[model samples]
Target: MSIERVEIAASPCPNDVFILSGLILNKVLTSFEYSFKFADIETLNELALKKAFPVIKVSFALYPEVYPDYQILSCGSALGFGVGPLLVSRKEIKELNFADFKVGIPGRYTTAYFLFKFFYPKEIQKIFLPYYEIIPALLRGDIDLGVLIHEGRFVYAKYGLFLVQDLGTYWEEKVNAPLPLGGFLVKRDFPEDKKNRILQDLRRSLKYAWAKKDEVYPLLKKYAQEPSQEVIFNHIQTYVNSYTLKLEGEALKGIKVFFETLNFKEDPENFIWENKDGIS
Candidate 1:
């Protein structure tokens, strides 16, 4: 019997690398052969739009547009309180003059961009750059303000940047829930059995990482943009919480609120994949 091949794509962020490390390293056992691709979140979003990979990580803000073609997997999400993207500037500004400053966004399809637009919906001079490039561009004066995500969130202060806004905090205060940043999505047309298998193995992969942090740390560092042990440790701790293990209760509620705020008409339940036997 020929073992099937599965194509997976995700960001190189610590949380994602930590969670998928087991699968990538063959630490977790699965029947299918898995191939992995690592890229920035925005790039993953664009690839997801083209349905390039069978399983991919994507910004939750882009979910509505990719619906029907892809549905969310219950495991492996970067959703939590205090984990939202940060708006950073070179100098302190008491109040934002949207039209006066050129703002840098990670990507148009990113949840960071969505939250930024949701809270500060003004026509501003917006420049889209890779998430990793936003901070450097800000310091170089290429952009007036930049929204920082992933490991950028933890290291922006070291770059002498001022926090203009904590978009996650804003969303939390307004929605009263954790901010849904991104999650794993599987193609809707994929076989149900294979989907469930992938979901099961993904959960196992996460658990494997948690149980063997020392073993997984190297893998996280291998792919992380900011590989400092402190930053990598904090990244995993912040983004990979109870929600990463399973998306329910507050997690589900947060996503619902986000969709409602965006005026998305699709019910999240219809797109979230749940095991048929009611097993997580």
Candidate 2:
């Protein structure tokens, strides 16, 4: 029989590499075949805007822009307490004027960018760079402050950068819930049967990885940005959690608040993939 296929795009960060490892390494069983296109989150967001892949990972901030083309999947999200982007600077910040300095952001469409804007709200001059390059650029004095995401969260201090603020902590203080970062999205036009299969495949893949973590460790190492096994383990343990298993309760509520704040076109109920009973 001919193989069924689906194209997917995601970031190459450890958390993503870890969660998708089972599927990428063929350690999980699925009837459908998947082809992957790995890139930075911003790049994935840009391509998703063009409807470039059937399934893609995107910042929750980009959901409004891509809503007409994609619906969010419940599984495989990067959402948790104290797990938001960080604002780091070469020098310590004290009584500083944010607008006076240029801030580096991962992408304008990223939840990191949105969270920064939510806190600062000033039209600060911003520089956008790939997630990995932010530290190097900061060291070279290319930008005053950079929003660090992915494995960047694990290694910023070793570069002699000072944390100006934990964006996740600020968000939790304001919203009283875990911050929603990003998740997998499938094309809204996919046939219902295919959608079910895709969700099932995703759940199974995550289950396999969690069950057989040692087996997936090598795969994680193969794709990790940083070579340190400790870093890879930290990245996976921080981002992948109960929220990743299924979006419900606080996770779902946080998403709703975000969409409402943005005044997005689609309601949370309509935007999420749903079943005959309700949101699955």
Candidate 3:
């Protein structure tokens, strides 16, 4: 029998690398051969728009627009309390006047961008940059404020940046749900059995990482933008949780509310893949 090949794309953040390391390292057993691509979340989002990969990670904000082509896997989601993007600035301003200042956004389609726009909808000047560049741009005074995500949340203060808001906390307090950030999406046309296999392999991969943190730390550090072990540890602990293992309960609820907030009319449930073995 010929082994099938699968191409998957996700970010290089610690949480993502930590979760997928098992599969990437061939520690998790699966029926199909897998190849991985690492890219910034925004780049992955754009690639998804172009249908460039069979499986990819994307911001939840972009899911609705791509619903016709992909179905979200229950596992490998980055959503939880206290894990939203951070709004940071070089200096603390008493009053936020959106029209007067320019802000750096990671990408137009990122959940960070969506939350920023949803809360501060105004005629604000916005510049889109890669997540890594947002902090440096702010420090250089190229932008007045920046919405920081991934490991940026952990290290922005070290750069002397002031926290304008924890968008995750804000979303939790106002919407009363954990903020949905990103998730793995499989092509809707992929075989159902293959999707289930992928989900199972992913769950095993996550569990494997958790069980062998010392073993996986090197892998996490390998791809992480922030090299500090402390920041990488915190990043994985913050984003990968029960939600990463399976999207259910509050995680599922949070996703629903997020789509509703975007005025997505389709039932969110319809877009989530239901594993045939009833595991997810």
Candidate 4:
């Protein structure tokens, strides 16, 4: 059968660590029975979730767990980068005093939000909004603190937002591995054979990119909205790491600990390479 185009949606975060790899996956897998398309999910997790699943068919995810109707292909790598969510306060709200502030989250039910809750249950009073709005809302004083993701992770400091905590770093300290930032996932109905082929290609792409950082940087520059090649390259380098697809040992342990804290109650301490059998 002539392969149909496979669509992929990736988060807009510079630290995404998976999008370019997916793009490269497309490049490497061209000889296989597949063509590819990729999209950015802006900064809204819920919006991404709503538009992504079933329709996207296969999408990149930073947070673990899909709608239970989804199947995880493989975690690209243990992105050694985890800058824990910052609790950037507006104006004079110097330190995080949970009772006094309403933190803004990407979404109420997101894993990142739950991470906030699990670590700082006292901050349960925090507000949730579409990921994009949190920063502006914080600037407007509508929200006291913003729990940002994506590019916000890098540039929040420029917005005069103080990093109260680097959650990813915190996670690493707590669990001793790269925080489970994100990876590729597909709907249950995706053909198992195709999914496995795509999964292998994703890993291959990272290997290919790592060998040619100079080449990968151009790809990053191509997609990056930033004008300065130097700036964009630096940003991409800061988050992308050697652990992009190999989420085993410490990385898996880190993710397990993360879920445990959220009461997710399971320790998938190793990246299960195969998407479970009979996954429909």
Report, for all candidates in order, the number of backbone clashes: 0, 0, 0, 13
Residues 50-84 of candidate 2: C-alpha lDDT, one tens digit per residue = 99999999999998998889999888899989889
lDDT values for all models: 0.90, 0.86, 0.90, 0.55
Using Cα atoms with residue i matched to residue i, what is each candidate's TM-score against the true structure?
0.97, 0.95, 0.97, 0.74
Span of 10 residues, lowest total lDDT, candidate 2:
271-280
lDDT of 4 by residue, 66-149 (tens): 544455455453245554556667765555566867788876645456556645767346676766678889888887777776
Candidate 1 vs candidate 4, lDDT winner = 1
lDDT of 1 by residue, 190-255 (tens): 888878888988998999999999999988999888889999999998999989988899999998
RMSD of each: 1.1, 1.8, 1.1, 4.8
Quantify how close model 2 is to the true structure by its C-alpha RMSD in Å.
Answer: 1.8
Badly placed stretches (over 4 Å) of model 3 are none
RMSD of 3: 1.1
Worst 10 residues of 1 by lDDT: 271-280
